[model samples]
Target: MTIRLIRGAAVAAAMVSGVAACSAPSGGSGGGESAYSVVIGVASEPDTLSPLLGYGKDGNSKIFDGLLARDADLKLRPALAKALPEVGDDGLTYTYTLRDGVEFSDGRPLTASDVVFTYETVLDEKTNNTARSELDAIKAVRADGDDKVAFTLKYPYAPFAGRTVLPIVPEHVAGDQDPNTGSFNTKPIGTGPYVLSAWSRGEKLTFKANPRYWGGAPKVKTVTMAIIEDDDVRATRLRSGDLDGAILPPNLAATYKNDSDESDSGKKTYVAKSYDFRAVTLPTENEVTGDRAIRQALDVAVDRQAMADKILDGAGRPAYGPLPIDDPWFTKDTERGQDLDKAKQILDRAGWKTGVDGVRAKDGQRATFVLRYPSGDKVREDHALAYASDAKKAGIDVKAESATWEVIEPRMKDDAVLAGGGSTGDPDFGLYTLLNSSLAGDGFNNMGRYDNPAVDKALDTGRRNQDEATRRAAYDMVQRELVKDPGYTFLTHIDHVYVLADRWRGLTTQLEPHEHGFASGPGWNIEDWQPKQ
Candidate 1:
C-alpha cells in the first residue's frame, strides 16, 4: 500500500525570465576597464551560508567546494579530489585521495579529516540537514591517512559518488559544534574559489576571489549577487548595462535575440544548456485527486506539446514522466500521448460527470482544484495557465493562482501545486529525492505527497545495486511506475538561458537542474576566464 500521509503537510506548499542590458555598476569604476566584476540577479536571497544546511545555490557554491563537480555534459570531474573515487569489489566501500596542497581560504591545509567531519556532521542527527537522506546509505566515513578519505556504505548506492557534490566543511571549526544549531550557519568558512566579503540581507551579497585557492586565483576579482524578484526589473538591469549577466525568461529571450543594437559593443547573450523539468503535483490525499483514474485523466488532458510551444516558447522539451528522455535510464518504451477522449472517459467512469457549467461534479461537489505557484515567477504562471486551459476540456476545474511561499506551504497538503525540480546526471539523484517516501519532509525535493510500494522498491534496488545493468533496470521500472500513476503531471524540460557581457570570456555552461549557480556557469571555470582584451 502507498503511504499517502503528507509529512510536514503544513510546510509542503511553500516553495523568473527575461534578459536585459548589462548595466554598469552604480558606484564602481566606470565601464571603461578595471578588474572584471559580474553582477548576477537571483530569484531569492540565499537562506544560509552554510553548505550543511543546503539552502540557496549561491551560498552553498561559495562557502563549500565539493570533492566532485558536474561538467557541462553532466559528467563528474574532480574538484577537490585528485580523481574519481575507487570502488571496492563489493561496491559498498569507496576511497578518495585529496589533491595535495589544497587549503581553505583561512590558510589551513585541507585534510581528509575535513571530509570526514563534513559527511559525519551531515549524517549526524544534530545537523538537521535536508540532504541527510542523500547520505542514508553511508555506514561510515573516516580518514585513511592525512589526505585520503574512505566511505563504507550499508548498501552499494549507484549515486553515492554524485553525493560527493556536496561541499566539505572544515573539521577544526565545526568540531563538537551541533551543525543544526551552530552560529557558523550564518557566516561559514569554505575552501572554494571565492570567499564571502559582505552580506547585506535582503539586498545583495559580495564575494572576493580567494587568493589562496588551490585551483588558482580567479581572473574576475569580485562577484556581486542581487536578489531581483521582478523578471522585468532583472531584464531592465541587464539591458541597461548595469549588470554583467542575468538568467533570461523564455519570453524575453526571443526579444533579446532579435535586438539589433549595432552601436552597443557590449551586446552579449548566452543560451546555457540545462535539463530542468517542470510539472504539476497532485496531492494524493486531496479528495479531487485521490483517485488514480482522476490523476491519469488530468495527465491525459494536458497538451504538453502545446505548452512547450506556446507557454515555454519553444524553450522546453515535452516530458511525460519524471525521468527526462535524454537520461540514459529513462524508460523509452512507456506510452504517453494526448488523448482527450480517453481522459474524458476516465473522468466519467470515476463518477465525475459534467454539470451545468461544464465542470465535472461528483456527490454534488465540483471537481475543482486550486493550482498554486510562486508569485512573480513567469515560467510557472505560464505553465499553470496552460494546464488550466487543457484541464477544461476534460470537465475538470483548475484555478491557477499566485501566492507567497509562506502562504503556499501550508496548503500543499490539500491543494494541487505547480512545481518543478530535477538534476543533471544519475537518475537516482533526481528520482530518489522526489519519489522516495522517506524524503517527504526531509526537503531533498519530494514536493508531491506521493508514495507507492513498487516505486519505493525500485528506487531501493536502483540505489543499492552495484552493477550498471541492474541499476538501469531498477530506474526503468521507476519511470514506468511513475508514468502509470501520474503523481505529477510532467510538463517539459527547460533550457537554461543567460545574457552575459561580451568582455567576459570562458563562460562554462552545464546541463543543470532548476537551481542555477557559479558551479555551473562562468564561475565554474572562473580561473580560466580572462577579459577579452
Candidate 2:
C-alpha cells in the first residue's frame, strides 16, 4: 500500500477520535530562551541510524553529520572535514583531514580511524549495505595519522566528493560488531547536534540536544517526531494545534490557505519550498510492460501538463524525461511530450488492437498490468491515478493498486510501481545510484530493475573524466539514452512544504534532492535557531 493511503487510514481514525481531543504537551513555552519542545509529523518511521545500513533520508540526516554540507545555494561547505579534499595529480586518490576537537555524543573523539571504519564497513560485502554500490569504485581506504584519511579509487570518480556526505561512525563503537548484523542499528552514536533520547517503534522518536556536540548546543532542546501516515490527518493535526509543524500534501496545501480564516485560531499559513521529482518505474523484466513499444506508448499517452495543473495544483512543472530541466546534464533537445495520435500509432504498430470494451488486446493479453504504489504515499497515489487515466486514452488497461514496500519490493521483478528517488547534495549522487546496473537489487536505489549498457558506460565515463566539459558530455549522453529507453516515466519535481507554529523562527529550508529529516530541513541550523520573544 502507498504511504499516502496508509496515512489516510490514520486521518480517518483521528477524525473519529475528534481533532479537538489532540493537545500540546503541558508547560509554559520556553520563554524565547533556554530550551523548547517541538513536534513534527513524518510519513513513516526510519529503519535504522547506522550509516552502513541506513538508506532512507530521515535517519541519514539525524544520527550522522557529513564531512561536507550543502549551503543554501547548494555549494559545498565544511562540516566535519576542514575543507574539500586534496586530490593527487593522478586523480585516483583523494585525501581529507578531519577537524580537531570534534566529539561524538558518546564522548568518543572523532578521528581518521572512525572515517576508515565507516567507509570500510560500508564497502564490505558482508554488510549487505544498500550503499555499497556508491563505493564500488573505491579500491582502498586507510587512515594515515589521527586526522588524515585517504581513499584510493579503482577509477577517478568525479562525484566521489559529494558521496562524502555519508556520516562518519565511531570506530570504538562499531569496530567489534560484524558489519552484516549489528545491534547498533537501533542505537547509533554520532556527532550531530541532536541525540536520540528514546524511540518507540511505530509510535514516536524523541531527540534531545547534544550539549557536547562540536557544533554547539541546539536552541531547541527537545525534538519529537510522531509517526502519522495520512496527509489529511497530518494537516488536521497541524490545524488543531497538536503539532508544531507537518509536511502537507500539495493538493491539501490550498485547503489550509483557503480555510485558515474560518477557524477560531484565526489563520495559520506556512512557507512552502520545492525539491525532488517523482517518477513511475516499469520493471523491464515484467511480462506486461517489458515491450519497448508499450513503454514508449505509455510515455507518449501521459499528459504531463494536465497532471501538473490538476493534480499538483500549479506547485510542479512537467518533466521532460528522466532528468529534471534544472539539472546541468539535462538536454534541451530531448524528446518528451504528450501525443495521443502517436501513442495510438505505436500500439497499432505493435499489433495491439482495441477490444469490444475499448481496452487494448495483444496475443490474447488484455494489455493489463498492476501499477503499485506505497499505501500511505499520497503523492505517488495521485501520480498513479493520473497515469491510469491517461493510459485509458491509449487503450491500455492499467490497474492501480496500493501495497507496502514489504510486499511491493519482492514483486518488483514482475510489476510496475509508482516510485521516487532523491539524494543528499548532487545530481550524480542520485542519478548514478538509480541507473547504475551494479546497484540493481542492492537496496538504497536501483528499484526499477533497469539495466542498460549505454547508461553504465556513460556513468563510468562521467565519473572518471574529471574535466567539467568531458564529465558534462558523458552525463548528457546518459540523459539522452534515458529519454529514448525511458525505464521510468518522469514526473514533476516537487517543493518541500512545511507548516510550523507562529513562534518558531530561523528555520532554513534546503532544496534537498531527498527528504533527510530535520538535518536537511529547518533543523539543519538548529543551534542558531531561536524562538520569538
lDDT of 2 by residue, 1-533 (tens): 11121112111111122323333533423344323777777566656667777433222365567777666666777778999898895778888988889999998899998988888887777776665666677899999999998989888777777777778888898887865567677777888888888876666678888888887787788887766666777777767667776777777666555253563243244433433667777778876688777888888899888877877787777776545676666788885679999999999999999999999888987888999887767878988999999999999888999987777767877788776655544446667777888877555366666799999998877766778888788878888887667777777666566655545568666665544344545655665677666
lDDT for model 2 comes to 0.70
Where in model 2 is the C-alpha error above 4 Å? Answer: 1-35, 55-60, 257-275
Candidate 1 lDDT over 2-49, as tens digits, reads 011112101221112222222345433335444467787655565566
Best candidate according to lDDT: 1
User: How many clashing residue pairs appear in each of the predictions shown?
Assistant: 18, 25
Please report how far candidate 2 places residue 410 from its true position, in Å.
1.5
Model 2 residue 428 CA deviation (Å) reads 2.4
